[model samples]
Target: MRQSTTTIMDSQVNILKYNQYFLPVNLKVAKTATTLNAKGILPAGTIIDATGKVVNDGTAFGIVYENVDFNNSMGTENVSVLIFGFVDASKLPTAPADAAKAALNMIKFM
Candidate 1:
């Protein structure tokens, strides 16, 4: 009988998102998450692209989802959710044209 071995390598920072795991610039699910409900990774210091005027990559500017301040009731219901994800500083409409690069302007909803 003969034995074989396989190896996988990665350099991207680990992140969690999309009910799946990803390694920055990559959206493939990890082998261990085959049966898990959510298994994804997001690279730190990374942003999702939102400037279609500049590029059409889904991996654009940083995107995130968060629910801060539960005081504001959308339907008279007292409920709140946490926040997550990444965004770029420029993509933010409120962000000045010359805004710094260390900021997020996009978001995702959970």
Candidate 2:
């Protein structure tokens, strides 16, 4: 018997109306080779690369709140985008060594 493998790729970003618990922060990001939009097409849960670019294959740093469009000048510019999203605590530079300890600290302090 022979077996085959399958791969799935998501190209569209989800645009949400509102998120009550979401705290969004803006980031200046550049376009990757695969990105189409000037604002960039980053789906929720997408990861950021070392150069501060959004890569589908990188380690996640945050979750996109909505489909964002940064280039309102109609492609006349290729400037870095100012996008916003919720930061992933686990990916934070100052994230605690212990998950439980982080959760406890969040509950007690924040």
Q: Which candidate should be chosen as best, given lDDT against the real structure? A: 2
Off by over 4 Å in 2: 1-18, 32-34, 37-40, 43-45, 49-52, 55-58, 70-110
- Please give, for residues 17-106, the per-residue lDDT of candidate 2 as tens digits: 333334445554544322434333444433343344454332333333444343332333232221332334443223323433332221
lDDT of 1 by residue, 44-70 (tens): 332323321111134334322211121
Clash count, predicted structure 1: 23
lDDT of each: 0.27, 0.36
Q: How many backbone clashes can be found in candidate 2?
A: 0
Evaluate model 2: give its lDDT: 0.36
Return the lDDT, model 1, position 81.
14
